[model samples]
Target chain A: MKNFDVYVKKQLLEKYPSMVFFLVVMLFPHFGAKAFGLFFIMLFSLASDVRQKRLDLMTFLPLNRRQIFWMEYLFLCLLLSTTFFVGLPFAERSIYAWLVLVRSFIFFSSYFGVIISAVSIGFDPYGAAFLFLLVDLVLGGIGSSQLGPTFNPYKLISPVYQANLLASLVFALILIYMAYRLFTQRGGER
Target chain B: MIRVEHLRKQLGNKQVLSDVSFTVEPGTIFALIGPNGAGKTTTIRCLTGALQADGGQIELFGENYKNFSQIYLKERMAVVPEERHVFRNFTAKDYVQIWSRLYSKWDDTIFSNFVARYSFDLSQKVESYSIGMKTILFVGLCVASQADLLILDEPTQHLDPTVRLEIMDMLKECASSGRTILISSHEIFEIEEYATHFGIIKEGRVIYSDSIDNAKENHRIVDKGENLQASDVIGLVGSSVLVKTKSDVGRYPRLNEIVVGYLTGHHERSLSLR
Candidate 1:
């Protein structure tokens, strides 16, 4: 398992430098906080594995399928956590920045889980990416509209963004669990 | 010894392997032969434990493979898959080093010797090596591991005739050293020359498997009399005898006579011909 981890990390490090450069250019300075690009970067990197068929190699290894899945999740989480720490000084030294960072990581991880599950079921990476973007945009629009004039802190519709973030985290967890189940089931037959 | 019993697998609606079973003893090279889409690779995948068998069991070295840990089983085995997928950026030496760490029995001296003998450029990235060179490196890794069981699928798929023969000789040498080898290939003639045992799979089943000499003796293409149809024969000693051709009242009576004469040696010559 440790060797496998080292192999994955080695592969990532070999490609991450160039990817970070591309991400930096695409989502330049002061774009809804630098951390916004981190989510996209994580998603793209995970999706890149799907596109290249590197994910298939995991199934061939001796480790449990679920264990492999969680390792991938942890690796992504570590990347997100590192990005958050690096961006902490850049964002104003306020609790909001920290909260946003945590919330974003949770939301991004959950979304990634759902997307990876979809990919496992024969979803094309580009199509899945496009669909994810469209769905997020629609949900974000709906939530922003609900948080319109005269926002009440105690109302069901109030604190709309936070509620959406919480919902995203819940859905992400569910999707990841489902993805884990699906991969394990398919792996058993392999 | 390696024993596979009732191994079965399905992918989507297609049944890849059904009730596949075979046993390979130590110091012997077994060739698994089949046409394309005949489930050769799928069966190999299951035996290597890369893919799970939907049903059945695989015992390697007198123990259930599933009961053993991955590292434990993998330490004693190595595979050279049909498609050689080496890490593109890593040089041949780096690939060897990485695999060496994975297999406890890996021999660095043997690896270095093979590298030198094969004239592989350790400095060049694996991606830069030609297909044949990549195959050489893949085989080198298997050899260096010193694993008791070596499973290869189409190991010579992309090599020139000379290199392919060299690889086959290497496998023979490995087997002679008391290791077991199970290889699947479409190259029948090459397999016929080196393999001690033969397992011919067709459409996900082991239609025929036995020692090479026994298989030859068992699957004879007997040409009978023009009026005596080949399909009409019953209680034949072998599995199946494919009839290549049959003609009536032709110049081939001597051929039929020759086959009948051979069969008489095994059976009662007094039996009346129809």
Candidate 2:
């Protein structure tokens, strides 16, 4: 499995330039507000590449389908965690900074959601990205309207956002588990 | 030894392999030959446990593949698949290091020697290597792993003749050292030279499987001095016959020739009837 890890690392390193660019943009003041959205998009795109390449290699090695799935999940976690740590030092020291970090985690979780949804529905990269973006946009719009203020943590603008942030984190964990199972079940077909 | 019994695999509506069964003896070279899209690669995938078969069983070294632990089975076998897929960003040395960790019995010295012998640059990224170079690298990795069984699908697909010969030599050396090899190739001539046992797959079925010498002897082209339809002549021969051609313009007028081909080439030794 060490060899397999190296293989995954080599692939991740190849895509490091794009990752760095995404991180830099997220750190920039002008783009900081939109960082969560961009991060969500980038995660799905990068995860798709990772999933496909790992699947291809699994075809050659004497590995079972389950091992391949777990390896990929582990790789995804490692990559996202590394990127998050690296970007931490550059974040601004303010209330918004903590919010940004929390939002970024939510964004990352949503990307996993996209990946799992894609696998479950057999959607390719383009379709998965489009679906994720569409869902996020609609959800964002709904959360901004007059009808949404009652449930809208964003409009409350203070302590409510913190509560929503915690809720979102919990929701993300649930989704990650669901996605892991869904993707693994679907991956057997490949 | 590797044994497959009644293995069946389906990809949606298409049945990739049905009731495919064969066995490979230790220290022998078993060649699986078939045309493109005949499920040769699919069969290899199933045997290697990369793709799960819908029905049937694969017993590698006495344990059923489905029941066997992946790490345990992997330690006993290495596969060089038809598609030469490798990490493009990794150098040759890096690639070898990664492979070494996968196999419990990897030999770094032997792998290094193979790299040098293949004339591959250790520092060059895998993406920089040509198709032939990539193939050589894959072959080298399989050989150096020192696994008991090597499963290669079209191992020499894109290699030049010289490189192909070198690979064959390497296979021969490995076999002599007590490693079993199962290879599939479209090049009949190359397979014919190296394979001790032959298996042919056609449309997801094992059409033929036997020793190479028996396959040649059992199937023979017989010339006759009379032109006749293939269907008409089929009843006259005791064994299965495939008619080469039926034409009336030859010097031997009314002559018809039939070529005998074996379905399995498993019959006992018989004296030449011709």
DockQ, each predicted model: 0.21, 0.30
Q: Kindly provide the TM-score obtained by chain B of candidate 1 when compared with the true chain B.
A: 0.81
Q: Model 1 over residues B183-214: C-alpha lDDT tens digits? A: 98887767866789977676677655778765
lDDT of 1 at B219: 30
lDDT of 2 by residue, A1-190 (tens): 5646754765565655555565445544322433443544345443554456445465455555456555655655555455555666776766675565556556556556556656644556556666655655554444542454456543322111323556667666776677666654444344
Over the stretch A14-129, how does candidate 1's per-residue lDDT look in tens digits? Answer: 45664576345323223244335544565556455655655444333334455566666776666656656665666666777667665666555555665676666666645775
Report the CAPRI category for model 1.
incorrect
Best by DockQ: 2
Candidate 2 chain B minimal-lDDT segment of 10 residues:
B251-260
Could you tell me how far off, in angstroms, the CA of residue A132 lies in candidate 1 after the best superposition? Answer: 2.9
Once fitted onto the true fold, the runs of candidate 2 whose alpha carbons sit more than 4 angstroms away are A1-4, A26-54, A62-64, A90-103, A143-174, A188-190, B67-69, B214-221, B225-274
Pairs with steric clashes in candidate 2: B225-B255, B226-B254, B226-B255, B226-B256, B227-B254, B227-B255
